[model samples]
Target: MIEPSPVKKEPIGKLISCVYRTQLKRMSRSLGEYGIGGGGQYSFLKAILMTPGTTQDQLTVKLKFDKATTARSVKQLEAAGYIKRSADPEDRRSHRLYPTPKAVEFQPVLQALLDESNARLTRDLTPEEEDQLIVLLQKLNLED
Candidate 1:
């Protein structure tokens, strides 16, 4: 009897993509529970929270997001009452991002939600493995 060839595992990119999709889905649901829109809001919120006076252009560059996406997220966040935009003092045409009190009050809880998402994803991995995974991920990011 001839033995069949051993099963081939999926490529690294495919695995990574799957994980990314699932992670986003989980985060969307988790964030929704907190009354915050999901998808791209996490990065926007974190950036605004960290730098109260960040400009839209700065946010686009820092987040590496396109102008359109940054604009849409800003509009959504503003409407959600989590953030507000004002004319930049130095640049008359540009606007600066600021977190509203609602955002500030919920910031800690939002952070915990982020932590929970990460903890859930890495629950099975040991401390050393988790550290190694983070380093490997950073290296992959640097490649891009």
Candidate 2:
């Protein structure tokens, strides 16, 4: 009978957290070069572009961010002229988010950066290998 390897496996959560933090640091440095601070701002902008007029509460749920963090990111983006917020006509108390012309202009640049980053990260991997890795990561989500 073949014996299983005795090497102790690191907890998946810690591995993921470490990778996420490392990626975030790299992304933050890149974003800082473009005069944007690190956080959920870019993701929020992309979300707004996809669903124009999305509410703050909706962003909170979609991004899995707390209300305060979402609000601060939105406010910063708005102040930076990247987004616009207007009161919802149907619900006076609610506000809707929209990407400004500036934000729209930045979309292609941001996407190119993301594409380049992905390409760089998977430079040595074959397409099939990359796909397999993505599938395996998706399987991890199934456990949750």
* Runs with alpha carbons beyond 4 Å of true place in candidate 2: 1-7, 142-144
Count of steric clashes across candidates, in order: 0, 0
Residue pairs of candidate 2 with colliding backbone atoms: none
Candidate 1 ranges with C-alpha deviation above 4 Å: 1-7, 141-144
Candidate 2, residue 14: CA error in Å? 1.4
Query: RMSD of model 1, in Å?
Result: 4.9
Please list all clashing residue pairs in model 1, or write none if there are none: none
- State every prediction's TM-score relative to the real structure: 0.87, 0.85
Highest-scoring model, lDDT: 1
Each candidate: RMSD to true structure? 4.9, 3.4
Predicted model with the maximum TM-score: 1
